[model samples]
Target: MNFKTKLLAYHAIAAAIAVIPMQSMASDVEIKYEKFPLTSPEAQQIWAAESNDATPLGEEKPWAMIAKVKVPGKKDLVVSQLFSSMHCGGIECPIKIMQEGLVISEGMACDAYEYHELSDDHEALMACDAIIPLDLK
Candidate 1:
């Protein structure tokens, strides 16, 4: 084979090897929620109560929801994940870390508790450990 052709082939193979693991490492997080459409009025109320300073931004309405999930062996674990359109009314919202109902560390933003809105590249359901609507009924 010509030297030019051989060089091109080597580059292509090297590129393929480098790309494959990055694709694998970019794994999709699997999230399971208790219900779809979260239609319960009670559930909506609970979410509203949890939302910290969630007021509508322009025409965009603020919202929240509660999620009941079973993670592997941990059955029926209820963890509240909140959403807000506004930034905590410019207040430093304390992020609580709890284990079995007792706060292990307070005011530390648990990586799991960090909030992000839904987007095309990322699913809100997947981004959050669990999802709660920002509004209550």
Candidate 2:
């Protein structure tokens, strides 16, 4: 190829490489605590413990699944929250909802706390099509 054509080809390849990563990143969803306005005292406490240096925030365990249930014409969306245990003990280790940043739901075992009452039932949990284990540490 002539110099101009060769230069144009190199530019096209470079542009493609740059565009590909951005597209991949756009498709990827990252769950972070800050995304949801979880400001309750219990949530705050959990957040603090997670940040502490001495806390034993172990590797994320596969706790729950998220499924994109089909609803006509609307965007394909998955239920945002999934089950996660921080590996802490007692009250600290209760199942948490990682998406939306707040604990929208918890296991029935956490019924002692009023907020945990918002948790989903077994049928709801089973409906999820995808499971992602959370790594709290």
| Candidate whose lDDT is highest | 1
- Score residue 80 of candidate 1 by CA lDDT: 39
**Residue 71 displacement in candidate 2 (angstroms):** 21
Against the true structure, candidate 2 has what lDDT?
0.33
Model 2 vs. true fold: TM: 0.22
Q: What is the lDDT of residue 1 in candidate 1?
A: 100
Candidate 2 residue lDDT tens string, 1-137: 89999999999999999767434332122222222222334344334443333232245332222223232332232333222343334443333443334443343232122222111211222211122232221
Error of 1 at 71 (Å): 1.8
Listed per candidate, the RMSD to the true structure in angstroms reads: 10.9, 14.5
Q: Which 10 consecutive residues of model 2 have the lowest summed lDDT?
A: 114-123
Q: Cα deviation of 38 in candidate 2 (Å)?
A: 23
Model 1 per-residue lDDT tens digits across residues 1-137: 99999999999999999767444432233333233122246335444334445655346454333344333333333333333435333322223222354333333122343342222222112233322221111
How displaced is residue 44 in candidate 2, in Å?
Answer: 23
